[model samples]
Target chain A: MTNVDTILKDMIIIPKGIFFRGSNASPDEQPIKQILLSAFAIDKTPITNKQFRAFVEQGGYDDPTFWQPKGWAYIRENEIKYPNYWYDNHFNQDDHPVTGVSWWEAMAYAKFAGKTLPTEAQWEYACKGTDDRKYPWGNKEPTLAYANFAYDCDPTELVRSSTSVYDHPKYKSFFGCLDMAGNLAEWCLDNASTNYKWDRDGKDPIYITKDEDYHMVRGGCGLHNEDFLRCTARDYYPVSVRDNLIGFRCVVNNVKEEEL
Target chain B: MDILDLPQVEESRRMVCVCNWSIRRTWKGVRLATIIEKAGVSNTNNYFLKQISVGTKEKGVYESTIPLEDALSRNALLVHSVDGAPLPMEQGYPLRLFDFGLYGYKNVKGLSILEVTDIYELGEWERRAGYDKDGIIRPKKYWMVDLKGWGFAEKPGEMTDF
Candidate 1:
């Protein structure tokens, strides 16, 4: 039996393979395709406000060295002091998923943690699991029991579940990761683009234009309906834009000596 | 053309223009004049106002606004129908504000509240990164120049030429 500390470990191993991505529910989500991913590690859960608070306490904002040039500019222009919803009472819980984090903030946290955000491909591979199901669980339609969604109760209800994040039977992935399908929307490293070719090309990642910087957010959130919880469903909002339903998970690439 | 059911608050008077294709579909709903008559505008010079659209999710609120004159125009209607069909989810059903001259983005979707204020406030995307506020649509041939015969190029220079 795994101890609580062992179960809460950072990196989750997702073996590489092609999996179907994108929902068939809408025209925009049409043309689902098989995506092949190299094996990688992803965070077991969404980043928490407590972790973000530690970053902020470390003067993440004041350190230019920690952020990319564009990220720094975005931080300055928005004058973002904290996650948009961090002021809300939900943040009091250490286990609650952090919201109000911009894509930039999420990236900063990943960097601070000595990790990187997973690419869209990596994210889809992890969420789809080895069997290539429609959601983390399987092809079955999502219900409230499978995920926290549709604002069934107060927005802060999920905070109470932090201590029990692993207890939920539906939280387990085929690969044994927790909460890949729902809880909060997770940010990916990919720049938001509609073109499949753009998504496939790993080098020279494209940044969404300033107007559409609301980059791609994957997985579903507590606010999402069953329809939005599809494993391949894609949603995006501006990078600087923050809200309570949005959060992120981190990924780390394990490099061997030869690769290094 | 029933106008009463549409939420006719004072802030509904304004609209924002996104792209230039401002096709006017028949919007038979409450007029800005009717809404203003009821809500009573406190500030006239503050043509620019912010419109916050609340979605089913509490955090799903999308905020935007338009010029006062744009908001007050006769063509501007609290549109309940598009082409006589109830608006679909893609079309901002139930109630949407449509302005004849403004681009599509100015026509906010899933509207919930309209606040009338004097501040020339930038909308969400605008305030964050100074995104294009003009809403002017420039003609372009195509995002992808040519799809036909597009294939792998052996040389990088050949790909560039293509």
Candidate 2:
């Protein structure tokens, strides 16, 4: 019975620090900086919907050369076709989380699962672990049964499960990672105006600005709010936008690199 | 006429269609065509007005909508005073809604309920995901504005469809 995709296939490293990213309740998440992050490797959950329906049944959405010409002009100008609650028939269950993709379809399903998408400092150093916690399980105040937010139920239950996706000892993570704050709202490769300023020294300011088409989305969903699931909560769209609480997860820097 | 003495407007006719920016301030309200002609709108109805935050309950509830003829346009304005100082919980205060080519997230904020309906509602970040529900701006030369070393162009008889 070892299938949470073979118990989350490899790489979770993430060792890095200097947290305090943004949103002291917004002055556009004013000036809060101090980034630093270096070590990477994420993806413990999120990217489900039965592994993106096996990357859209192996064609990865009619392969426009594996996308990125503004994500094939936003999937040929929004004919998008699937993945936002996938026409909602409970989308083949198995622990949900895989909504209307599109950070270039989660970087083409992390380059067809070889792996690659974390980098907003490796997803805020794996959601502020090493004790920087604004969340990922710290700095309190999430409620709605401690995760899966927005009043947690009675919205006629669309997709629920958060008590045992791996023995929820309060959904672990001091680097054991499990449902990193709620469930859904991942996707990061940096480009939501790449701001740095964590003290304006020399290296750290990226905030990409040419022809900006939007990129950065980070943890914060279960309907979102505790200041957008904080771990420096920042959100963005336009990587050919798609939604339904957004979804993503895949970052194999290499664990016996089978070819990623 | 007393949503706390409404009357505040001017982020320049308020169009922020996700940052295309607009500005013309000097407002103070009660106009949203006088609250839909005092809530009597019924010309085969086609309304859309959401502006929550008095203890939001959820189901995509941040709120923002318009187009019942731009909320009965007579220069729509449920405002609660801005420049003359009264509306400021980060600029949405006790009242909000001041349209004119609407955008700035449909100028919604802290005004409780206004669901007049005819069928077309999905506000709050567009049904909790999948934004840009036609918050279309399309003038920045069809976006692609250069990624780093910035450059500029487009003027050779320019007419890229506004």
Candidate 3:
């Protein structure tokens, strides 16, 4: 195990263990269960246009190795370049969280960055933190200090948000990860699994199966209502489906020997 | 209403058979009784539920209602659990109303405001697209099916890249 702090400057360590997952209010969110996770390093925020540009400049679209087998076939078949929101082959701003990228695009970018999309369990573990606060800022209702949500900004204008990821201090998780609750609902590594198989006896359980078509996306986005702003709210779409409301953060299985 | 503050009640049922999106999904959740009780409407025993509206900030509204007695039934649910787990977004994470008697449109997703008013009105699709407001479903209920000509089967065109 390598020391996360020594190996990476921007990522934060989400300590491993049992974390509170799911919500009690919704039926699909029932069976509020706990699961164990191994320690890992996760990005402090969703990827920005500036970060994604490196992948694009590295010829991410043309490269085959960074992509999954089917992802390569799909993107190549469509001749896709840039995200869905990009116009004239350019993003609105360099610092804005990159939106309109499919799960495949986001996953490929994670590979290019030497990281992986956080698993659904890992993503939930990061948000739930030590105390399992409803929002990353705790049970408090969101204000401008919390998230870019509730249709507060124009959806069109969000791709060019002046709110750099670091702006929401209140939205930071207990581990010092910002935008874990809101920004753009991030893509996770797991395929959509409503069956939320709780592994109380197992360690670092990732709940996904091969037959799944939809992939999990957590955290809420700019145009969502306050109901979606909570940490427990889970979202998903077809891996190939691209939308302006979703972006993603990356995680790595980096554990420090000293901490271990 | 504060979701946490609401009187939490866990109820499971086997009746949900979503024809379009989900097929034979077992949904468990906090009871509509608990939700209405949380909304301080426990006194609505005799009065029928006229309109129960659930909506997102971006999308206008997805509204439907049930009779008071049916809304209070054990089978009907204000579901959050899909197959023994926390709901996912496209399936409505924090909450999704599961009215087994009515069609899927009444089982709204992305609940921001759940206004329970005595307003007997058709939801967005039921009125605009000519779906039967009183969508009753049974395997042999063929007569009711024709009333729902274009029914809630049509997906929204405005949903561009959500």
lDDT of 2 by residue, B32-97 (tens): 665666667656256566555564455334765556664454366777776687878766778777
lDDT of 2 at B37: 60
In order, the candidates keep a fraction of the true contacts of 0.00, 0.20, 0.00
A1-260 in candidate 3: lDDT tens per residue? 44445435577776667876777754445477767788998888778888898888889999999988888886787677777666523334776678878888998998888888898778877876769788877888877668776432224552334256777865577677887665678988877654455445546766665522567778776655455667777655566656566889998895765644
What TM-score would you give candidate 3 relative to the actual structure? 0.58
- The digit string of per-residue lDDT tens for model 3 on B1-46 reads 5554554556433232222122345566666777777668866655
The order by descending DockQ is 2, 1, 3
Cα-based RMSD of the predictions, in order? 11.0, 19.2, 16.1
Q: What is candidate 2's lDDT per residue for A9-103, written digit by digit as tens?
A: 65466544456566454443457665665445576666677777887888887887666677767666657755666766543365667776768
Q: Tell me how many clashing residue pairs each candidate has.
A: 9, 24, 15
Q: Which candidate is the best by TM-score?
A: 1
**After best superposition, candidate 2 residue A225: deviation in angstroms?**
27
Off by over 4 Å in 2: A1-38, A41-58, A62-101, A123-235, A238-260, B1-14, B20-30, B38-75, B78-117, B121-162
Q: Which wins on lDDT, candidate 2 or candidate 3?
A: 3
